[model samples]
Target: MDPARSSSPNPATLAPLDLHASWARSREFGLRPDDALSDALVSPADLRDRLEANARLLTFSRPVIENLFRQIGCPSSTLLLTDCDGLILSAIGDTGFLDRATRVALCPGAEWSEAAMGTNAIGTALTTRKAVAVEGSQHYLTRNRFLTCVATPIFSPTGGIAGILDISTDARANLSHADALLRTTAECIEHRLIENLGEGFLSLHFHTRPDLLGSPLEGLVLFDEAGRLLASNRAARALLQLHGEFPQGSYPECFTTQWRHLVAWAAFGPLTPFPLRTLHGQTCIARAELLLPRAPHGRRQAKSDEAPGRAEAPPAPDTDPRLGHAGTLVAEWHRNRCAGPLLLCGETGTGKRHLLYQHCRDHGIGMPLLELDGRSLAARAQAGRDELEDALRQTENGLLYLTDVDLLPAEARSRLFEAAGSSHRIVAASRHPLAREAEGNGLDQATLARHGAHIVTLPPLRERTDFAHLVHRFVREACPGRPIRVLPEAIDRLRRYPWPGNISELASRLRLMLALVGDDSTELRPDDIPDELLETAV
Candidate 1:
């Protein structure tokens, strides 16, 4: 059974909280308005001096307004979203109206309920709770004569009108043929609202109506941080034979097995060489957001469609089970200059594996990265007892990153030593410092002496200066339009965080945010960031 279907609140009947509030409050707040709590949560102290709810009017309307004026081919359009009262919660139009509309209160806080503006779409849509249009001369106001309007009521999941969505175009223009454009824009806005205010980590759009939202394509889509779909337009849905919603979820869990490995690419540190996958069927990559919740929720969103092509083949696990240390160390090793067989000693997430690969690349070295993760190799050895030994002998001018070097089963260690004796550079990463894990409990003179010259300890993201920008860069890359610039205060919050999962966790959190609140504007407001991110202390 599809999990989302079982959990979703039926959209037909209105929920109690949503019932009378949006429509009624439209009048109460729009005409004689006061502040309402932000959809985001905050501490008690911060709410003392809140701005009026009218502030959200134009601030929120600008995106739609900008899209109408610039993106759409329409000759002229006016956009608005209203509250219960007949006030102009927010309004935007072409330069012609924008200049004249400023003569009245139409900029942000203009009241335009049925009582104030007299039976126009903004008020009538809320008052009658139905969409309406008053064309040139049909409107009560003289200035409305040259315009033809189309409007719809947007609703909360519970069936209450959250706001009104309307478009007014020049009557003289071929605006009658634009029903498809109106519907698509409205749906797109609804999707944005759903992501901002509801449950569910993923949002998938199939091309049922291109006139409503998105381009004319039919395929599966997964968005990057800023919330644009990855690939597979509407057409992919028919191709994949998907009968249900796509997959969306929290990090390390929601994505198919492939995503976890793809994310592991973060250990490469700087952005010098961007390694992308072209063979994965579709070249669509999402600059997706972090999906971790900033607070609690009552229901969950559905999953995004996942057509995982292949599992990336990484080196085998070493004898030790230190998961992340090896990867981070490899990442760091690659960053260091002329760093010899650097001995990486640390717990998981310290990033030893990535550093090793980077080491080879930086030096113009392109040999196969071999692994004698002693335990696994030893198991295969006892079982096979074949030409495997010869393969180990032939890896000349190549790299062998031996993870859990300290746990090298006697035979594998000997092979490694023999290999190290040759020209092959054996960069071994261990969980424990060689001296600490000494075989005799005194000084591990033998093992320590063999891999002596190069030992660099790996540190977690919490201890490194590289983390802030690293975290910022990942979040920005994933969320293309989201203003990833950390608010000075947000940066202060990041500084105080003790990153347990290191870079991986940071990237994951960003993905979560991108999936949740997707605002990729050049200048971002604090609320665009997740509340948990806001709560972080410096």
Candidate 2:
């Protein structure tokens, strides 16, 4: 519901009644419009107590507040987070802005509630329990008319206002974009607060589209061991049409998917998406994360692969020399851990996609991986459906991976760069380095310059030192439960061939060799190798 309509006003009604009410409240506080502003700060001891009381909010909100300030990039703008009472707990901005704001008591330790600060954005939002903007003369106090502020209340788990996130700037500054960003940022913070309540809760992350699974816009629902709804965020409430009654229902009342199936999926991992349908028939793609309590320390230690009671043998070591270096490059560009997009380049069958997945899994990067075939994206764009932009809206915290990016049409390439910008962490794969492709008129020069900041090139299979290891591993997987011994001469004969088709060709030939194996034969000989592979001997 819109805040302005909270008083049950008609859609066409309104002469700024919310503001008028705020003005009335200010007058009731005995604050004169022409009165001099107070520049006093709360005592140091009191400030310390407030900070300690809201430590969790600060821990989760600090990074978001800092990032918001960076995005504003205005020397006259300041970002602040305050408790429910409007006591400022954290403040960040340009040095010049901070100095100016401190004089108006807009810094940390100052109270900005409506009772003390008149009709200001932070104060008004808290009183109305909604997002609001107070600009220029809208402020009841004459002293505050020089500032423009937009604020939104952050809700706690129990459905009360936890705090307010506000952006204050010069009255002359335009805030058209700030309002939207502030709301989204507050939601992101609220989601984090709910996630922190993990013990004995089963958290469900879902959306109508699979590509949107890990994004901030995804609906989050928390359930207890008995499958009772314990808490939910704004997105969840809207998606489920809870109508203001949440945290009292059970899982069976909400979802048609059995509770046991959800538990089974959670025990495996949150990587795969399952079909989740509500009783109302809204189909959703969802992932479940089971947050069961940890076992005793000794029991937990025994479950580790390195523990003394390990039953299965450890896997063989990788012989690929390029994999480790590529992993470091990937970590450097991961959005949650670092910054920027990663451009992966390699020959066909050189395992570019494999490397991408391996690095993400090894590092425990849990964000959803939304892979888009560049050719398909371009095709859709030419058909007039702006698919790239649609995907961008659903990929706030996802890994957007584009495969065969070199195949994109010229117009689609431009659209990609413009639509993606810096709002997402994109990983694009191409058959060759983007710069080289640009020189051949297959890519945009500016696109190469932007995405080429960090590039990881994969070596062809023939050039890899791990050829033998990969062959053994692939063969083992291809013919499981029926082990075929590979002779030394057969291995040498295979290495003699120049593998222009790389790893993919090798696996194909191995599958064919396995097909020719007789029921009585356990050995793989050189004579069983395909004729074409031998004909291409170096």
Top model number, lDDT: 2
lDDT (tens digit, per residue) of candidate 2 on 95-136: 787888887899999999999988899999999988889888
Candidate 1: segments with Cα more than 4 A from true spot: 1-342, 372-375, 378-381, 384-391, 437-446, 451-453, 495-497, 519-538
Candidate 2 ranges beyond 4 A from true positions: 1-16, 38-40, 245-247, 292-323, 331-341, 344-387, 390-414, 417-425, 429-538
Using TM-score as the measure, which candidate wins? 2
Model 2: lDDT to the true structure: 0.72
**Each candidate: what lDDT?**
0.46, 0.72
TM-score of each: 0.35, 0.66
Q: Which ten residues in a row have the lowest lDDT in candidate 2?
A: 297-306
lDDT of 1 by residue, 1-538 (tens): 5332232223343233332333344344342222221222223343222225433333333454454443345645666665545444556667786665455334445555654553355666666555565555444344444556656565432234556666666656555543444444444444434444433333333333221122222223443443333333224334333333342222322233355344333322221122232222333322222332323342232121121222112123322222344455555554553344546665555566656645543554433344544334445655422333543543444455666665645555555555553346567767655564556422253655564435666776667646545655655455433334455555555556666656656666655555555453442335555656535445
Candidate 1 versus the native: TM-score?
Answer: 0.35
